[model samples]
Target: MTYTIGFLGTGNIAADMARALNGSGHKILVSQRNAKTAAALAAAMPEVTIAPNETVVANADILFLCLLARTAAQVLPGLPFRADQTVISVMVDMPLARLRSLCAPATDIVLTIPLPPIAQGGCPLPVFPDCPALHRLFGDRNLILPQPSETALNAHLAASAICATLLDQMMTTADWLAAFTGDDDAAQAYVAAMIRGYLSDRPRPGALPAALRGLSTEGGLNATLRAAMAPAKDSLRNGLDGFRPRLGLPLGPEP
Candidate 1:
């Protein structure tokens, strides 16, 4: 059965989700806050259209909320929300409890983390302990990881913020390689494919240790590079652990 999916914000994640869902039979209604993005998405997808936030709330069967947590407090309470429509927040740092209060009377509230690659399928999608609505929407498209608690979801939230930085790091290396190869495209393709293949073949249960052991042969180039990069990796991990506070999330060691 087709559902009407309304997006309250047209930020990165929302845009990507709309892009991925394009051509699907579901009706996709989007809020007009980020007018440029909403218009572009509507123009690109037949099932998608731009609408006022209240209209989106009233018309949609499901709402994918991407508003900033800081502003959500000021914005959501003003709009009338239905008890029957499911509200799935893709915003970071905003707890389910707060969302419940703001979107009260609308009990089917859930939390979700969607990566850009979800449109292409095969990425890991994280949702709350008992949110079946999320699984129904994203389960077949990606690996569904049903986190046991909000804390667990937050841990994933911190970790999820690193994908772009990881890409940037890869691009830095690729740029250096471009200098040698005299072709940025070839260097990027090679680096991207190499890194992607490494990621694809990562060991299931004990990825970090298995990756270290598998890649670092004695006196090998991989071993040497790993040693040189240890500090940077540590910084990245530390930075991720502390990033939630910047997003206004309650920060404690991941439970």
Candidate 2:
């Protein structure tokens, strides 16, 4: 079924979503808060239109809340949401209960984290409360990971921050290669292609550990690098543990 998808905030993520959903046979209504982004999206996609926040809420079947937490708090309370609309929030650090309260009497609230890769499809979407509307919209192109709880969804969101760190590490490796080869573009392309090829294997459950074991062959360069990165791995774990309090999870070991 085609949907009237409304983006409550026209930010980068919202723009990306608009791009992803452009030809999905659904009409997209993007709020005019970020006029430039909304206008650009409308110009690029005939199915998309820029509209007032209230008009978006009044017309949409599924409303995506892509606003900042502060902006959502300030804006949502003023909009008129229908009881039939499904609300999906991508705002970081916003709790489900708070969203439910702000979006009431529209009880179909789902929390999700959609990364920038979504525009090109194949992005992993971590969604809370297994929303059928989201599945209908994104199941064909993206991986919809139905999270068990809000905390689990939040954990997935927190883990996504590692994408930046991974890219930084890749760029550092590319810089080192460039220093040795004196070819910056070639180094960067080689490093990016190598990483992409490695990740494209789509490891099955328990396959990651096997891949690591295979790579860490004793006395090999991969083994040497893996050994050297042990401290970095520990630091990554500690960083993830640091997010427990913010994610409303227990301070100690995960239950």
Candidate 3:
């Protein structure tokens, strides 16, 4: 059945989801907190309308709380929601208990991390305590993975947060290439294509060590790069370990 989906905060994540679900036959209502963004989204998608947060929450069949943790905490208490409405949240650090307390009238509340790639149908979307609405809307276009526990969900969260480091590395690599090639466009295109192929060829999780060893030929470019970045890799790991505490989760091995 078609549902009216509302987004409380129309930020990048919400906009991405709204864009992906635009023509999926669901009426999307967004709040006017960010008027320019809301208006832009309405113009870009079908059946997307801008409304007040109160109206959006009250009328929505499924409401996605996409606000930052602080904003959500401040705004959610005053919103009116039906006991039957399904609530989904994209805020990373908000606990399930806190969400339930704040959105008590809503019987079904799901916690998920809707990554930006879903907007382009690129990767699986992660949800905890599976909900049918997630599947009904996004399953066809992308993989809808209903994680069995929040522990598994946090692994996805960690990966999502690592994009900043990856981008930093990629830009550095591209810059070095451009320095040698003297052509920025050629350098960027080459680095992007190489990275795409590398991602596509990565081994299954359990066999990563073997795959890494196999990919680095003795005296090859991969080996040389690995050697050069060994120290940096250690530093990067130390930096990423900090994310777990911020999200209120234990630091541990990622799947």
Best by lDDT: 2
Each model's lDDT: 0.83, 0.90, 0.84
Kindly list the per-residue Cα lDDT of model 1 for residues 30-126, writing each as its tens digit.
9997988888888889898898889998888889999999888888997879999999998886888999999978989888888888767777877
Candidate 1 local lDDT, residue 91: 85
Give the TM-scores of the predictions, in the order they appear: 0.90, 0.96, 0.91
What is the C-alpha local distance difference test score of candidate 2? 0.90
- Tell me which residue pairs clash in candidate 1: none
Query: How well does candidate 1 match the true structure in TM-score terms?
Result: 0.90
lDDT of 3: 0.84
The alpha-carbon deviation from the true structure for residue 122 of candidate 1, after best TM-score superposition, in angstroms, is 2.5
118-185: candidate 2 lDDT, tens digit per residue: 89988999899999999899888888899998888988977998999999999999999999999999
By the lDDT metric, which is better: model 2 or model 3?
2
> Which is the leading candidate under TM-score?
2
Question: Which RMSD values do the candidates have, in order?
Answer: 2.4, 1.3, 2.4
